[model samples]
Target: MIKGNLAGRMGRMGRMAGDSGPERVLVAASFANRVGNGLFNAASALYFTLVVGLPAAQVGAALTVAGVIGLFAGVPGGHLADRRGARPVMMAALAVQAVSMAALVLVESWAALTVVATVDQIAAGAGGAAWGALVVRVGGERPAVFRAKLRTFVNLGVVLGTVGAGLALAADTRGAYVVLILGNAASFALCAVLLLLLPRYPVLEAPPRRRRWPVVADRPFLAFTALYGAMGLQYPVVSLLLPIWISGHTEAPRWTVAALFAVNSLFCVLMQTGIGSRIESLHDGGLAFRTAGLLFLVSCPMMALAAYTPVWAAAGLVLAAVFVHSLGEVWESSAAFALGFGLAPDHAQGQYQGVFGLGFSAGQALAPAILTTVVLGLGATGWLLLAVLFAALGAVGPSLARWGARTRPQPAVAAEATG
Candidate 1:
């Protein structure tokens, strides 16, 4: 049943981007890139701690500081893409990433590690913004749907990479870890080369008299970003808080954490495109966000209640909660793609996406400390409060979206009339 469903969905995605050479190239590059990322993510911490001999606390602190610094890279990166063209900027970012990843091999101390990690994170942020702009050029009429398809391939690639990483983990040797790191570096180089095959997109010149940072001055979009960031709290809930919550608070086996992650990944691979297809407009995006919030509300309490259940029941409840949460994740992701792409002007997609990325990055960075305090320290009540937060964000999403839409300059309308 799963195979049939996935195959059918894959078929639909293929037809959606039929005969688009750039789209195919982009998907292949993204898949390759993600596979490398998965390998690095799985083994990098162990490599740093065990092989490089950095203290775990120091490693965490360095990464946190690096992430904070990297947050500032997006806007400049996007602006550069707008000025110099996204394709070349994206290739440049990938090249930097390849160099940074390769340089990781030379890091023997905390300071070296921090420097390398910070550089890699900045490149990633910039590359992401440029990639968003490139997608806008290549994604034909429905970029969100195309991005959803890309995400499906991304999940598949990550799964494949993680499976490969398992071998290195089992080996538990410096040689194996080095191989993983080098493999990731090679993938970045490969991605850069592949991007060269893409057609050059013309750089969009900003209008005379436009503000230097229009997105910063856009109040309604910023409000939307805030709510989107709030919705993104689900990420750390799954990645950080849930595992701790399951292990320390609930009677469910420790392995349930892995099981839940597997469920979420599988759901994304099979269902993302389908859900994304439904979110074609800002109104649809708003509705999707609301639905996601409500689903999270349902799942959060179920997760909390699992702490009080019997062993078998606790496991069952947690599994169900994760399933529900995965549904919400799919909806939230699809909605975000729609709103993020739809609300932005065609010429400013890079900068707009860069600005939009800030919210998610901020949520990811803050979620660890905030969730640990609220969900872990405060317990079930904290979960309820979190649920209320998501619900409120969802409740207001439509109004926020409408306001953004109303405020946007109707360049498309003028172009349409002139054409």
Candidate 2:
């Protein structure tokens, strides 16, 4: 009987991975989209500097400006998705991305680059909001689990795309770069086409006499966003701060940075679905967030200690710390999927998701400067402080999630019955 139960559970998991036709289509679309993103991420800087003859500083400045401008697009785009329908908005955004990527091949000047980049960023922000809403509709009962499955495929696609990028980077010619850019553009077009295969979702109706900007007015959700944003510092800690620390401060080889990244990615691909499957409720999510925070506490100190160790010891310590950090990342991400989806009203998922994304994006924008000043500047003391901050944020997650849940709008029937 135990063996039979285990086999049945495995079968259920298999079904969950691609339960519906729309879910499978969405997964394919997400994979195709991320593959292009991976290629662009690996090669865009080199292409702009070497092939297009643009200065590095100008490129950075343009990208920063574009990121800042793009932040505003999510809210309005999500609102539109709520009103018009997520599927149509998502297709429109993908179409815009395709056009913007094609335009990048023509960019020769900073002005041209900035304009095209800004448009691309805006489209990306809008599309992200629509995607979140669509996921809610397509995922049926277990959206978070489905999202986890999608992330696994997304990582695989990126790995594949990076391999393609490696060939382009090796060629190191204008033609190769142009081909890379066009490939990304084509991917976006293809993703849009794939999205068309999914069934159309009907527009969700808002509550009668609802606030004009209900998500904006949701203080509990806003508070949760702030905490989530604070915890998001973990991202830059891994990507930006650790590399600098490894190269300049630790006795470890520079190659450790790449190894650590690969470790993190592999962990995500392998473990994300399992972790997400476990966190099925807000309570589970809150606990997972707390667990992530505690893990961060343990890992951060180990990372700090790496700077003081000998070469071999430093490498071992850094590797161990990153392993813990990656586990925390999986837990934290699972918690986010649960809370981000659970706290919002059914009709306004797009708006709520957009607002939630604002916090993450804002944190991302600020993380580089913050990490440089705090962790890099202060050394061991900085790492401890950041760890404490993450723990504190995680510790409060349950209470704040409870608050958000309490504030959620009731169903029309329930409200009418209460009245």
Candidate 3:
């Protein structure tokens, strides 16, 4: 009797632990990949300038060119995944990226850097599209839950990788750089192997061959995507703009920047899953997005307050702003995932996700110049303007999502062949 009771208890415990096959593998693989990426990102610029003997400007130019070119490949990548299968496409992309990372050792000049970077960026876009489709396949009906969980783990992995990268930076030798680079390549290889271990799901039936972009035809969905992308400006605001905003504009100490980022990362790791769980349907997701906008509106003006305060007071305000901004980030991410999976047609998931992703790309591309003009160029008034902008966009999200819900296309099946 006791043995049976213990066995039952163990089974229940396992369920509570949330142990599953495919989601586990996917999360583990994502962790490895993110860690590798963090390592590479931490060292790549210094590697290019010091070890590869290229100018910093040349490296930046190479990256910018690669990013721009890769942005256009998302749609084609999705198309390829739809025609083929997500697993195959993902594995192939992983293999290509692994090879690209390994090949970085051979780069010696600006030309070589440009070529290598371009290839790497293209593979990254394809891999990203494939991975999103795979989450849908593996998560079965609740891909957003799986995706949100995956993101949290990814953040944890990046943190660990960043710690490792700090060590590499301290070592700062050509040999050390080579090791980190190769470690990233090896990590991708491991990710590919892990992906193959997961059960492969069947592909959705492809639609009849068409030259036109179906995703483009979905106008309301496109608007939703664009709006979400605009919210993505928060990314640049934290990573790119904030440091400059602090040093150039605010009275906060420069060291507070690191502290602020730490808070953001920690908050995400701790709070994302909790916040993500509440976003289930399109309505819930839209509400979360609206909440995110309100948070942003409050955060920006609070951040503006930092500029007029004393050092400690400014730091306190910035810290508070960071916390508020991070909540919005979680909300935005949760909403995006729900909509990303919920709204996309099953047969055209890859293409839809790719197209939807353009909003993120567009937001990233546009934020720099736009923020520079208002936030930096105009100062406090500009900050207030940015706040209003976020409020307006977020306020409109629910309506746009409702419109999007109406526009979702019926899944187009591969027309059955006549006998």
Candidate 4:
């Protein structure tokens, strides 16, 4: 009797743990993926400009090419994710990324870097579609719960990766580039392993012979895509150019930028789930998007003004900007994730995510060149202008919210076939 009682008790505990098993696995895998990518972001510019002796503009140009290519890559990537289920697509893409990262570290030539960047981003685009769609599928109507959990893990990973890179830079580690690349490759492998623990789910495939770009014909959907894309464009300003501005204008240690970013990531990890859930629950997601957008507008000009203020005050401004920007990210991301699945039929989730990727690709691709030119030519004032552009994106969000409210829900099979 005692043996049976103990066995029953243990079984209950096992079920309790297993209930969260898939969600936890997805979150852990996402965390590793973000951490590895964060290292690449932290180190890549220095690797190219200082180590490889390439011009900054040249590096930006390469990213531009990658971004443009991603525009085309999205269709197939999204389609595959929906058609093939998230597991295989994510695993295969991560595998490719692992190979690419390894090559990037070993081959340091400009030719090699360019090739790696191109291939890596293509794989990344595919993986991103799968990841986003999987989040929706796994979380169902509560995408906020999943996204927040994922974001928290993502932030943790970013913190680890950035802090680690800061340490490498401080030590002037000889194999710093190799360390970053190898770390990225390992992270991808970990993502695969973590994903393996999740329950198997079918991929959401689009109908046979469905054409690409037709998604744009859905006006409300297109507006949502554009708004989300604009938000992504602002990320370069936050992550890439903002650091450059800090380095040039202040006596702040280079690692301080990473540190500030780490702080922001930590906060995001803590708050994203709650904030994302709240926003998703709103009857009008656009209102939440607008609030987030306005916050960013208020914050962006402060980034540029930090240069003119007292050094201590400038530091405060940068921190404030980071906080606000992170909030905007949470809002925008929550709406985007929720709508991507909510608006589509089960079968079309893949295409919807893919179509969304096109806008993101365009925005990110243009950001490097545009921000670099603005900072170089006009300095801080240029960034302020960029902020205004971001703020303006809020106007579009309301339309999307209204569209969300008004769009006619299609029959399930037609929704699947159309997607």
Residue pairs clashing in model 4 are 82-204, 85-203
Clashes of 1: 0
RMSD of 2: 4.1
Please give, for residues 355-387, the per-residue lDDT of candidate 4 as tens digits. Answer: 787777777776777888865468867877767
Worst 10 residues of 2 by lDDT: 410-419
Residue-pair clashes per candidate, as listed? Answer: 0, 0, 0, 2
User: Model 3, stretches more than 4 Å misplaced?
Assistant: 1-19, 206-212, 409-419
lDDT (tens digit, per residue) of candidate 3 on 1-419: 99999999988644422348787888889899989988988899999999888888999899889888878777788878887888888888889889999999999888888888888888888877888888888877677777777788888888888789889999989988998999999889999999988886777785578434677778766877888888788888888777788998778888998998888888898888778876866777778889998999999999888888998899999999999999889998998887777777777788888887666886788889888876788888888888888888889878876776666543311110110
Cα TM-score per model? 0.94, 0.93, 0.92, 0.82
Error of 4 at 411 (Å): 7.7
Cα-lDDT of candidate 1: 0.87
Q: Compose the digit string of candidate 2's lDDT tens values, residues 238-293.
A: 88899998998999998899889888888888998878887866667778889999
> Which ten contiguous residues of candidate 3 have the minimum total lDDT?
410-419
Candidate 1 on 8-108: residue-level lDDT in tens?
A: 99987676443388998999899999999889899999999999898999999889888998898988899889888999999999999999999999999
Candidate 4 CA-lDDT value: 0.72
User: How far does residue 250 in candidate 4 sit from its true spot (Å)?
Assistant: 7.1
Instruction: Between candidates 1 and 4, name the one with more favorable TM-score.
Output: 1
